[model samples]
Target chain A: MSTLLAFLLSNHLKSRFVIGYTLILLLVSSALFIFTDNPQKGLLGGVNLVLLFVPLVVSLYTGISLYHGEDFTRVLLTQSLSRNQVYWSSTGSLQLSLQAALLVGLGIPLLLFAPGMPAVALLAGASILSLIFSGLSSLIAFRVNDKVKGIASLFLMWLAFTLVFDGLILLFIQLMSDYPIEAAVIFINLLNPVDMCRIVLMQVLDAAALMGLTGALLTEYMGNLFAILSVLLALLIWLIVPMELSRRSFLNKDF
Target chain B: MLHVDSLTKKFGRLEVLNSIQLEFQKGTVTGILGPNGSGKTTLIKCLLGLCHFEKGNIALNAISIKSEKEYKSYFGYMPQIGRYPENMSIGDLFELLVSLRNQPENELDLELWELFKLENIKSQRLGKLSGGTVQKVSAALAYLFKPEVIVLDEPTAGLDPLATEIMKEKIRKESSGKITLITSHILNDLDELCSHIVFLNNHKIAFSKSMKELKASRQGLTLNQIVAQLLQGEA
Candidate 1:
């Protein structure tokens, strides 16, 4: 498995798309730090960028690369290795490559300018989100064999998680303003990895106070440690469920 | 020995192969002949475990395919169109496959590798190779591991005349002491290379017989004429 993983990672590293992605992240984060006077302000921008950009790029890139490598995957399946090894190694290589890009692209700037718990939180949140989306992409790639349909579905998923879900939650809260629904809203928010990541970053950045009622309710209901732990748990679930589902589908799929 | 018993497969309500039963002993080269969409590929895919079958089982050397993946080590396959990673150089691809197999270097079969002169183009990326060259690569990799059962899908479809002759000679050389299964539209090639031939039509085997039996049954008729007569009879 490691041999396959190393080979896939080498192939991925040589691609122009990955290099361009890494360079874009490096440039954007570096510029954010250099131009802003306050590191916290830059961290705030970084959070939004990570939340908006990371999932979209990771999901699309992983999906497309998997499709492109479909033929090679067939070749691998014929070898002595188990299907689990092939699926995991290919997905692992994609996840690790993207995460490394995130770390280098965002890690350097955060450490150089804003070295604190908030910076660490930002990095962790971004890395976990990248992994979560990679898993989703793998699931899509395995489940939908057609390349165009798979990509379309991936874009829809990113839009739902990042944008549409938040809007629906806001509408739900607005419509049920008379009732005590703080717990329900919080539970619903937990379902969206993007929102949970944002909450974690905001809490650590001391910007939770800016969240108004939601922020106050979050702090009052669940302590800082509990909130972070629960969010991390949610993120972990997001990572495992999709990956496991994809693995099963891949094992049984006809090449 | 390779044994396939009552194998049945379907793809979304369309039956591709129905009750396929076959057996091959060592040193026997069987040609799988069929028209387009006649389940030739599906049958081969079933044998390789690439396509899941609805019923029946396949056993190689008395080991069932459903038991564990260890049985797959005995087989080597060459896909009709070899699609490798575009950026991967031939050397790296060979190294990867060699390491995965973990066979001793001295025991490796370098006959096809040296004959194809792949060493000279070791650094070339797979995407840059011509179709015939890619076919050569697939052919070499299939024989590199010295598998007990070898499957070649359209082995000489895109090759130049010289390469085609070279492949046929290699097949002849390796056919002894190994079970070789080939699927091709070129009857002349099969006539020259295969000891036995299996014909598939309408999702089932039409006939399977040795070359001598087929020739004796239809005196003075070439394989092409024999197969054409069979198809006409069915029509």
Candidate 2:
């Protein structure tokens, strides 16, 4: 635990990118709360910002963090610690720090402007996404040996999640317009963390009017508690699966 | 003491270490010498359990290192290149190590810290230090824990003369009642500090000899000359 804290604290102090990202998050969240009139509008604005930015930043940050910490990782290996300790501490600390950043970046603003169920739900969702992506980044970093390729793959994955996957989903829906594909669409949305998050946020805000066809269908079919809980459960799976993979890969890796 | 038996490691089709067998006894400094890409680092990594090996076993203090981690507590390693967390100041790095080792504040060793004037630079971040300074930091950290086994890879590669002398003195002092394994291309440093020599060539132990044995065979020849002659014979 101390090892994890020290590692994360060291990263927070040394990496300019981390410092800059923290500052940007603070500023953006603050501005959104101050400028917007409707609390729900501000909440939606923050949600959109997080949905767009959190995964990208988490992936890139986790990728570079794992790559840059190679020497430190070796250092830990030589120490009086177990491989499990070293791997988990490094990953756990990075995940915790990123989650903390999300809390401060979005949690603070939401609490200040729109303190309610929406804020709690959004915060939980944002934290889940942060963990999922950071875990994803670490898995990618460990699996890929080359740094350039690793980073490129990470961004590509992010692209697939945020933009390409959804676009492809829409395309699929359009192509199969003659048939009833709502059930299939609901299942497909569960596969993507970003989509799962979007659906959860829509349900929480009771903004099904804006949920499009798939979101409305999911809401109508599953209702709020079932839809949100299942999505939340899916997000947790997203977090745990990649984390387990990266841990195993890291343990087997040669420093 | 350390023992490695029939150790083998490969990267794809290229074998780096091939069924290597070796041992180091307590109270001796064994220097590992080899040509580039000869798996010196790989061997060290295997010993520290940082890398996986395809075959063979390693034992420390007569206990198998297989699926066991507590054995590594006996080792203190300094890599060929020193790389700390970039943003961490020297003090913070030390603090991190202290906490990781779970040692209380009072038991920490400040010998190398004083000898290297590390206190003066405690405020400096690792990223800002020169190569020599980083080497000094690595040396200090490796020696800090006072472990039973020490592995230093190119320990003095980038040090200035004074720092190198200090390092040599430290290695010599620590050589008593402990096993010290070092790897370096600087033959003179090996000559000055090592009691035993293990030469690796073509993924195998070409020869392993005590410094006294080699010296006795070729009277009045320095280690440098002896090794040069041996390499010439191989060529």
Candidate 3:
């Protein structure tokens, strides 16, 4: 299993795109984190970037490799490994390697910048983000035969999250400006992985900070403890939903 | 050593393989003869359990393909095209496989190293190699494991005449001792390497017989002539 993971990493690492991938994300995340007034808010921007950019980029890589690697897949499958071992081992390997790279590029630097940040909270947030995006991208990439189409779908989905989602949120807030409803805000926040990540991270910094915001809609109505825990629970759902759906498709999938 | 029974596969409304049953004897080459999109590739994929089918039972060495992992241990495969870590040197790529499989030196697939003339490019990366070279590397990797059952898809498609002869010899030798399945358009390859032929048409087994039986049935006709006789009407 470790070798399989290493094989995947080594193969992708060869593309000459991986260095640029790491550097560009590192520079952008760091710049935004440093430039913003609140590093916490900068983290929000980073979440938007990571969630949108990372899934698409990773999906493209996996899509092309899976289609082109048909020969290799044949050789490996013909060997004495059960479908269960093949499925879990390869997925396990691919997931951990990408997660490791994510840790190095994003997690390590963030921790160094914020010495006061608790390790457990930061790790939990990062793992959930990585799990949700990685599983979702891999499954989509595998389902499609055309690499370009799969990649396009990933980018478009990311675009919806990065751009259209914000626009929709603005329109909603504009309509509700007079009302300032607490329930609406909490529910809207719950629907998005990126938004859920921010609320959880910010609450970790201080539950009071989130409650003090304009309406404190979430912290005020749901109460600080419930809202914080709810965000964590939402993160769990993000990981579970994609992984389960992908797993089901993958098990019976014709590849 | 391999048996496929009533294997039927459909993708959407297109039925790829329809209730095809065939058994391969040990120590004989089974050539899957078919044209493009005639369910040749789909049958191979389903047999290997790489693709799901609506109906079928595949067994390798008497173990059900659906439930057993041991089939993997029994074979090696050379795809029509090979793609690997283009950045890693040949040695490193093979070594990674060795380590992953926990293969001892005895299990190493060095038989084709000399054939591939890989000594000069042992340190070279896969992406930098030419197409023919890439094909050679893929062939070497597939046969290196010395598996009891081997599958080669158009194994000689990109090789020079000399490399082609060497590959034919390797396939003939492997099939004589174990089980070998190959799919190819080249009738000459079957004449040179295969002991039997399994012809597929319209997602069904059109004809399956040993080379001797086929020759007896169509007395004085060549393997290509026999195949042409069977396939021309379907086409």
Residue A214 CA error for candidate 3 (Å)?
A: 8.8
Q: What is the TM-score of chain B alone in each candidate?
A: 0.98, 0.95, 0.94
Candidate 1 residue spans exceeding 4 A from truth: A209-213
Candidate 1, pairs of clashing residues: none
Clashing pairs in 2: A14-B87
Cα lDDT tens digits for candidate 3, A95-172: 665566666666665775554554346556656766776677667765766777877776676666557766787788
Q: What does TM-score give for chain A of every model?
A: 0.97, 0.95, 0.78
lDDT for predicted candidate 1 compared with the true structure: 0.90
lDDT tens digits by residue: candidate 2, B13-78: 989999999989999999988777778889889998889999999999877776456687677888
lDDT for position A255 in model 3: 65
The DockQ-based CAPRI class assigned to model 1 is medium
Model 3 misplaced stretches (Cα beyond 4 Å)? A13-15, A30-71, A118-127, A173-181, A204-215, B107-109
Tell me each candidate's TM-score. Answer: 0.95, 0.94, 0.88
Winner by lDDT: 1
